[model samples]
Target: MSALALLDYASVFVFALTGALVASRAQLDIVGFVFIACITAVGGGTVRDVILDRPVFWVANPNFIIVASVAAFVVFFTAHLLESRYRTILWIDALALAVAVPAGVAAAVAMESVWPIILIMGVATGCFGGLMRDVVCNEVPLVLKQGELYVTCAFAGAGAAVVLLTLGQPLPLALIGCAAVTLALRVGSMAFGWRLPVYKSRPPRV
Candidate 1:
C-alpha cells in the first residue's frame, strides 16, 4: 500500500480507539463500542469524500471497516485496564488528527482542488470524526469548545502543507512536515495547557 493509504488506515484505527474508549467511559455495550468506533473512524473522510464527489472511502475499500472493527474490539477487551487513563484518548486522537489532516489535504491536492478547499478538507478530516464521537457520546464537541485550539492546530498544519506545495516541495516531505507541525502543536497544547483567549461577555444591565 502507498504511504498515504497506510496513514489513512492508521488514522482510522487510532480514531476508532478513541471512540471505543468513549463508549467504555459511557458504560456502553459491545455493539455501542463498535458503532461509535465505526462512525468516528470514517465520519470525517466520508464527509470529505461526499463533498469532493469521490466514492466514500470505506465503501470503496471495505478493509477499512474491518480495521475499525478490530480496533473497537481490542479497545473493548482492554479498556477496563485503562479506565483511569481514559484521557489517553486525547493524545491518541491528537495523533490521528495530525495524520488525517495531511491525508485530507493530499486527497484534495490529488484532485487539483483550490488551496482553500484543501485547507477546509484538512480541517474537516482532522476534526469531524471526533465531533461525531463526542456528539454520539453526549459530550460537547471538543473542537467547538472555547480555546481548545483543535481546529486551529489542523488549520496551521494544513496551511503549512499548502504553502510548501505552492513552493514546490515534494509531496511526501510536505505531508510529513505538516503532520509533524500539527502533532507538535497539539501535544504541546495538551502538555502546557495552551489555550486561545476567551471572549468575555459584558455583564448584563441590571
Candidate 2:
C-alpha cells in the first residue's frame, strides 16, 4: 500500500478504537458501537474530502468501514476489561491525531494546495472525527477542551511540514516531522500536565 493509504488506515483504526471506547462509556449496544466507530473513523476525512471536492475515502473503498466495524466489535466484547476507558481513549486519540494530521497533510500536498490550506486541512482531519464522536456520545469534545493542546498540536505539526516543504525538504521527511511534532506536543500535554493558559473572567472591567 502507498504511504498515504497506510496513514489513512492507521488513523481509521485508532480513531475507531477511541470511538468504540466512547460508546462503551455511553453504555451503547454493539450496533451503537459500530455506528459510532464508523462515524468517528471517517468523520474528519469525510469533511476534508467534501471541502476538497474529492471522492470520499470510505465511499470509494469499503475496507475502511470494515476496519472500523471490526474494531467496534472487538471493543464491544472487551471494553469492560479496561480499567480506565477514558484514559485509553485519550492516548489512542492522540495517536489517531498524529496519524491523521499527516494523512491530511499528504492529501493536501498531493493536491498541491497552498500552505495555509494544507495546515487547515491537517487540523480539520485530526480534529473533526473526535469532535463528532464526543458530541454524539454527549461527552465534551476534546478539541474544545480548555487549555488542551489538541488542535494546537495538529496546527503546529502541519505548520512544521509546510515549513520544511517550503524549504525543499522531501515529502517523507516533512510527514515525519509533522507526526513527530504533533505526537510530542500531545504526549507532553497528557503526560506532564502541560497546558495552555485559559481565560480568567474579569469582574471589574465595567
Candidate 3:
C-alpha cells in the first residue's frame, strides 16, 4: 500500500481503539462498541469528503471499512482486559491525533486547496472523529472543553503544514514537521497537565 494509504489505516486503527475504549467504559455491548469504533474511525474523513465535494475515500476504497471493522472487533473483545492500562490507551490516542492531523493536512494540500482552506480542512479531518466519539460516549468533546491543548495542537500542526507547503518544502518534510510538532505538543500537555485556565464567575449577592 501507498504511504498515504498506510497512514489512513493507522489512523483508523487508533481512532477505533479510542472509541472502543470509551464504549467499554460506558459498558456498551460488543455491537455497540464496534458501531462507535467504526463511526469514530471514519467520521472525520467522511466530513472532510463531504465538505470538499469529493467522493468519500472509504466509499471508493473498501479496505478502510475492512480495517476499521477488524480493529473494532479486536478492541471490543480486548478492552476490558486493557482497562487498567488506560495510560497506554491515552498514549495511543495521542499518537493517533498527531498522525491524523498531518495526514489530513497532506490530503488537503494534495487536493491543491488554498492555505486557509487547507488549515480548516485539516482541523476538521483531525478533530471530527474525536468529537463524534465523545458525543456518542456522553462526554464533553475534548476540543470543546476548557482544559487540554487538544484542538490547539491540531491547529498548530495544520497551520505549520500550510506554511511549510507555501514555503515550497517537500511534502514528506512538511508532513513530518507537522506530525512531530503535534505529537510534541500533545505529549507535553499530558506530561505537564497543560490546560487552558478555567474562568471564574463572581459570587452571587446574598
Candidate 4:
C-alpha cells in the first residue's frame, strides 16, 4: 500500500477508537458506536476531498469504513478494560490529529495547491473529524477548547511542511516534519500545559 493509504488507515482507526470511546461515555449502544466511529474516521477527509474536487477517500475505498466499524465494534466490547477511557481517547485523538495532518498535506501538495491551501487542508483534515465527532456527541470540540493548542498545532505543522518544501527538502522529509511538529505541539499542550492566551472578561465601567 502507498504511504498515503497507510496514513489514512492509521488516521481512521485511531480516530474511530476515540469516537467510540466518546460514545461509550455517552452511554450509547452498538449502533451509536459505529455511527460516531465512522463519522470521526472519514469526516475531515470527506470535507477535504470535496473542497479539493477529488474523489472522497472512503467513497473510493469502502475498506476505510469497514476498518472504522471494526474499531468501534471492538471498542464497544472492550473499552471498559482501559483504566481511564478519557485519557486513552485524548492521547489517541492526538495521534490521529498528527497522522491526519500529513495525509492532508500530501494530498494538497500532490494536487499542486498553493502553500495557503495546503495549510488549510492540513488543518481541516486534522481537525474537522474530531470537531464533528464532538459536536455529534455533545462534547466541546477540542479545536475550540479554550486556549487549547489543537488547531494551532495543525497549522504550525502544515506551515512546517510548506517551509521544508520551499527549502527544496524532499517530500518524505516534509511529511515527517509535518507529523513531528504537529505531534510535538499537541503533546506539549497536553503534557506541559502549553496554551495560547484566552480573552478574559473585564468588568463594565461605572
Query: What TM-score does candidate 4 reach?
Result: 0.95
In model 3, residue pairs whose N, Cα or C atoms come closer than 3 Å (at least 3 residues apart or on different chains), thus clashing, are none
User: What residue pairs clash in candidate 4, if any at all?
Assistant: none
TM-scores for all candidates: the values are 0.94, 0.96, 0.90, 0.95
**Alpha-carbon RMSD of each model:** 1.7, 1.6, 2.4, 1.8
Give, for candidate 4, the lowest lDDT window spanning 10 residues: 197-206
User: Between the candidate structures 3 and 4, which one is better when assessed by TM-score?
Assistant: 4
lDDT of each: 0.88, 0.93, 0.81, 0.93
**Can you tell me which runs of candidate 4 are displaced by over 4 Å?**
204-206
Q: What is the lDDT of residue 90 in candidate 1?
A: 84
Query: What is the descending TM-score order?
Result: 2, 4, 1, 3
Give lDDT tens digits, candidate 3, residues 1-206.
75566677888888888888877778888788878888888898889888888788799897887787787788777765764745765787788888788768867876788888889877888899988998988877766756678888889888888788889998888888888888888888888987666666688744
Ranking by lDDT: 4, 2, 1, 3
- Candidate 1's TM-score: 0.94
lDDT of 1 by residue, 1-206 (tens): 87667878988999999988888889888888999999999999988899999988898899999999999999989887874645788888898899999988888887799999999998999999999999988988878766667888999999999999999999888888889988988888888878677666689745
For every model shown, the clashing-pair count is 0, 0, 0, 0
- lDDT per residue as tens, model 2, 126-191: 999999998988898999887778898999999999999999999999999999999999999999
